[model samples]
Target: MAHIVVLSGAGISAESGLPTFRDVGGLWKQYSVHDLASPGGWERNPQLVLEFYNTRRQQAREAQPNAAHTALAALESQHRVTIITQNIDDLHERAGSSNVVHLHGEIMKARSSVDESYLVEMNDQDIALGDLCPQGKQMRPHVVWFGEMVPMLESAADIVATADVLLVVGTSLQVYPAAGLVDCARPNCPITVIDPGEDVKVKGATIIRKTACAGVPEWIASLKL
Candidate 1:
C-alpha cells in the first residue's frame, strides 16, 4: 500500500468551529501572545494559562470532525495514512485515522511540570491549577508552548521522507520546524496542497486552492489510489 502523509494545521480544525491561534483578533478582543500562549504567560500567571487552555479543551471536545477530517480518514482503506499535525486536538483520532503524530503535543493530556516523561491522558477533563501527577508535582497541559522544543519533529520528518503521497492542508507553511517537514519528502513523491489562501512557496507541490472541508474530498476522489 502507498504511504500517504498529511501535514495539517489549525485551518483544518477551524472548519469545525475551533478558533485558530492567529485569528482570535476580532471575536473576543485581542490579547498579546505573551499573555496567552507563551511560557512567560504561564510563569506570570498559571491560573490564566490554565483557564485559557481549559476553554480551548472544552471547545475541542464539543467540536466535531468535518469533511476534511473524514476524507483523510477515508484514505486509510486504500493507503497507509500517517497524519502529522500541528494541531493539539484529538479530532483526527476521533475521526478514526489510525496513525496520527501530534507535533505540538495534545490538549487532552497532562504531564508533570517537572518531568516531561510523566505524561497522562486527560480524557476531556481540564487541567486545573492544582491537579497533580503521580509524582505529586503539579500537572501542566501537555501542549508545546511557544518556546518549547517539538519532540515529534524528527519522527514527522521521517514519515514525510517515506511518503508515497503527501498532502499539505490548512497550513500556510509559516511555522518553523514543523513547516519544514515538507522539505524532507522524497523529491519525486507527489505533493498536493489544499488551502484557500494564496499560493505558498513550497517547492515541488501542486497547489489546490480551496478550503479543507470542500477541497480534500474532491482531491481524494480524483486520485487513483
Candidate 2:
C-alpha cells in the first residue's frame, strides 16, 4: 500500500473552532506565551500554566474533527496514512486515522515535571496547582513547551523519509524542527500543499491554495477515494 504522510498544524484545527495561538479570540491572547507555553512560565506561575492547558484541553475535547480530518482518515482504507502533526490535539485519531505521530506531546495527558517518562492520562477536567504525579512531583501538561526538545522529531523525519506521498496541510513551514521535517521527503515523493495562505510553499509541490477543509477533500476526490 502507498504511504501518505501528512504534516499538519494549528490552522487545520482552527476550522473546528479551536483557535490558533495567534488568532484574535483564542486562549493565547489572554496570556503571554512565556506564561503559558514555556518552562519558565511554569516556573514563575505553575497555577497559570496548569489553567491555560486545562482550558486548551477542554477546547480540544469539545472540538469535533473537521472534513480535512475525516478525509485523511478515509485514506486508510486503501493505503497507509502516517500523520505527523505539530498540534497537540487528537483530532486525526478521533477521525479514525490509525497512525499518528504527535511531534508535540498530547494535551490530554500529564507528566512529571522532573521526569519525562512518568506520563499518564489526566483523569480530571482540570489539573489543580497541587496535582502530583505518582512520583510526587508536580504534574504538568504533556504538551511540549518552548525551549524543550521535540522528542518525536527523528521518528517523524523517518516517517517522512518513507512517504510515497506527502501532504503539507495548514502549516506555513515557519516553525523549526517540525517545519524542517519536510526536507526529509524522498526526492521522487509526490508533494502537495493544502492551505489558503500565500506564504505556504514547498518547492515543486502541487499547491491547492485552499483551506484544508476544501483542499483535502478535493485531493481525495481526485484520488477517487
Candidate 3:
C-alpha cells in the first residue's frame, strides 16, 4: 500500500468554521499575535493568555470537520496515511483520521508551565488561572507558541522522508522547519500541493489551484484505490 503523508495548515481548518488568522473580523483581529501566542505575552499577562485560548478552544469545539478532512480520513482505509498538521484543532480526528502528528500541539489539552511532560486533557472546558499541574506550576495551553521550539519537527521530518506520496494542503510554504519538510521527501516522491492562493508555491510540486474543500475530494477520486 502507498504510504501517503499529508502536511496541512490553518487554511484547511478555515473551512470548518475556524477562521484563519488572516480572516477579517475574526477573533484574531481583536488580539495581537504576540499577546495571544508568545512566551513574552504569557509572562506579561497569563490571565489574558488563558482567556484567549479558552475562547479559541470553545470555537474549535464548535467547528465541524470539513469535506477535505473527511476525504483524508477515508484515504487511510486504502493507504497508510499520516497527517502532519500545523493546526491545533481536532477536526482531523473528528473526521476519523487514526494517525495524526500535530506539529503545533493540541488545543484540547493543557500542560504544566514548567514541565512539558506533564499534560492534561480538557475537553469542552476552560483552563482557569488557578489551574495548576502536578508540578505546582500554572497550567498553560498545550501549544507551541512563538519563540518556542517545535517539539514534533524532527519526528515530522522523519515521517515525511518515508512518504511514497506527499500531499501539501492549505499551507503557504512560509513557515520554517515545517515548510522545509518538503525537502525531506524522497527525490522522486510524488508531491502535490492543494491551495488556491497564487503566491503559494513549492518547487516541483503539482499545484492544484483550488481550496482544500474542493480540491481534496477531487484528488481522492483520482486515486487508483
Instruction: Using lDDT, give the best candidate's number.
Output: 3
Clashing pairs in 2: none
TM-score of 1: 0.95
In model 2, where do residues sit more than 4 Å from their true spots? 24-30
Model 2 has how many clashing residue pairs? Answer: 0
Clashes of each: 0, 0, 0
Q: For each candidate, what TM-score against the reference?
A: 0.95, 0.95, 0.96
Residue-by-residue lDDT tens digits, candidate 1, 1-225: 989999999999999999987665453345677877888988898887788877788889999999999999988998899999999999999999999999999998888988999988878578888898787878888989998889999889999999999999999999998889999999799999998999576787889999999999999998886
Model 3, residue 121: displacement in angstroms? 0.9
Cα misplacement distance, residue 36 of candidate 1 (Å): 1.8
lDDT of 2 by residue, 55-76 (tens): 8888888999999999999989
Candidate 2, residue 50: CA error in Å? 0.6
lDDT ranking of the models = 3, 1, 2
* Among all candidates shown, the one with the greatest TM-score: 3
Model 2 TM-score on a 0 to 1 scale:
0.95
Model 1 lDDT on a 0 to 1 scale: 0.89
